[model samples]
Target: MKKIGIYLSFAALLLTVGCSDWTQMEPVDQQPVRPSEQNPELWAQYTAALRAYKAGSHTLVVASFENGSTNPRVRRTACAAFPTRWTPYR
Candidate 1:
């Protein structure tokens, strides 16, 4: 049948093209490399900045503005509760 001939031609084409030599490709290493290996001071400074920012430093202030509108009374109450730590945004 014509269908059998078409299927046979497709199978022969696939078999001839699929025999590629992939052995020349480079193998990937399984070991993980540390950042300090590339640059020690750069890695150290990066870690220090991360620590400083994570500890609630003013360098990276987070604002909360998800709720509908910010209530003036709530803001005043929060500022009154923590005056030294709070800095109002204009």
Candidate 2:
């Protein structure tokens, strides 16, 4: 029948459109490495802050370090150690 032929053609067209080649997805830049990654002291400071937060010592956790350290590297290291989150002392 002509209706059956038309239905098959429409189904073929739908299948052709649905079976697209989706292999080339855009690459995502996941979790970029920071310059501080190479610096051991900076990493230590960051880890210490994280540990303090985990240990629930909110007061001891430094939000920001004094910027006036004689060594610029020390100041930078301390700055990186700043806590990412602050919880009020209960």
- Best candidate (score: TM-score): 1
Candidate 1 residue lDDT tens string, 1-90: 999999999999987778655545778989877898889999999999989878864665689635444564565444345556658888
Report the lDDT of model 1 for residue 39.
91
Using lDDT as the measure, the top candidate is 2
Candidate 2 lDDT, 37-74, residue by residue in tens? 78879888998998988888455545644576656665
Q: Could you tell me which residue pairs clash in candidate 1?
A: none
What's model 1's lDDT at 76? 45
What do the candidate models score in CA lDDT, each in turn?
Answer: 0.74, 0.76
Over 4 Å off in model 2, which ranges? 17-20, 23-44, 54-90
TM-scores of the candidates are 0.37, 0.25
Worst 10 residues of 1 by lDDT: 72-81
